[model samples]
Target: MTEHRPVNITGLALKIPPALIFILWIAMMATLRYIFPGLNYELFLTPYVVGLFFILGIFLVLAGFFSFRKAKTTINPRKPEKTTAIVTSGIFRLSRNPMYLGFLMWVIAWAFMQANLVTFVFLPLFVFYMNRYQIIPEEKILLSQFGDIYYRYLNKVGRWL
Candidate 1:
């Protein structure tokens, strides 16, 4: 029998938790808002728009969480290798990363509530950071774990929709 070694697919050395990253981005957005007070400009029915997005974000997150629970797979973002099964049903079918997408929506809602154009800059930054440090690493581990099945799923689904 040959010995097998687990591959270190996550190239990132600094593994910041996704929640912490979210908080940090929120802080950065707030700081930007404070720095550029003149940038604040509200839209008509801004509160209602913010509320709609917030509720939608919350719904997506809950849907993703419940789907993972029903699949009996690990939802912990940091431990993709521990994911026992590939979740392809429910919200997972719509977007491969519904939880992250939900979080992105929440950030967008917050930015809208802030009514500052400068705060909007953090949205793309959040996506870039998640893609580089979180999503890519997780995908590498999933591909290593589930192989062709995961590849097929990846092809079938959008990363964020």
Candidate 2:
């Protein structure tokens, strides 16, 4: 008999809330841009912020890519059900949530390039969502599947280092 694991309530809340917030953020930004024709809020291209965001985004994407490749795992958070291996190498050694880290970096880049204060809303929301849904639930499954090996790895690596 196949055992059906129930969905996590926090995970559900996390996933839906940020998705809606992200959509709202996009809508609001588009509306504001339409209303104010001269307002140029480029989070990634902003003066000094440009360098920071560009570096961050590149670092995160590369880190996550290498880790996912090393583990031979999918980095998609929406489809964690398909993960074939536990990634604990490269950037994974530094952070347990490299994909989320990459997303965060992207958000930071968005905030800088857009230079819109409102875009900041999605930053924290994204982190909250990943922490609640992706990281926590995936950790549970990994602990259950990999046993003490996973725990040892967890001990060695910080969740968001």
Candidate 3:
């Protein structure tokens, strides 16, 4: 079941910033932890897990950001059409959506930090929403802008490895 939403309510396919959506997911996870305090578990390696994921998360985000900067492409998710180049080096070589993957890692860190099973449900939801509303639209714009070069890169990398 999807929302009774109009297709492209404006010329823009994206309405919300991905960062804001990430924040919303984090907020929802926190709310779930508060409302369902009993849904938590004991993880002896919680600190290690959280730290590793947090570090990897930040690393991937920065790597993606820097790669975009070096490639002279638009890093702004709101303007995929403005992307001047298709970056497939560094972190981009691993995942097409490295920044989003980093965000997912941060979400994982938050879930483990809470030690709450309920909050973990947002993981798949986050992926689903991002693929449906964010990545697909961005891919369309990239494909239109960069054509087969973008298509080849899409085939070469996993969306969220």
Candidate 4:
């Protein structure tokens, strides 16, 4: 008989598409601000910070998307086994997960826009969830699928730059 792996009873592992999760985080952040209006705080140069982060967010996202397109590889995050090639071009040179990084930047931008100190809490939570549920799982699949080739690439690149 073939080997069978244990599965997550919650059916969450490697199941939810990361974009959906990102959008969920955005919604949650906005909801937190709504629930606690007084949580809003002020910072110096909020507009400039928001502008810089938002632009950087979108830029990294598009760069990562296009890099995958140029490489003609899979962009599906929920299914890492679908990946056809190791992308090491463009933004991938700087970050192994630029799209995720962009999503994080967008979260920071949203937090600034809300000016809610409570909203800022989601930053670390976002990183934690993504790292635990998404990145680590993806890394395992890529490592298994690509073997030593991907291992070397992993050594050379940071997960988020």
TM-score of 2: 0.67
Against the true structure, candidate 1 reaches a TM-score of: 0.92
lDDT of 4 at 116: 88
Ranking 2 against 4 by TM-score, winner:
4
Please give, for residues 110-138, the per-residue lDDT of candidate 1 as tens digits. 89988999999899999999998899888
CA-RMSD of model 2: 5.0
TM-score of 4: 0.90
> Please, what's the RMSD in Å of model 4?
3.5
**lDDT (10s digit) by residue, model 4, range 1-161:** 11323333234667777788888988998999989988788888999999999999999999999999988898988877788888998899999999999999998998899888898999999988888888888887787777787889999999887
> What's the C-alpha lDDT at position 109 in model 4?
95
lDDT of 2 by residue, 41-158 (tens): 5433376775676677678777887778777887665555566777777777788766556556656665666665655666777677667766777676666656677788889998
TM-score of each: 0.92, 0.67, 0.91, 0.90
Model 1 — which ten-residue stretch has the worst lDDT? Answer: 1-10
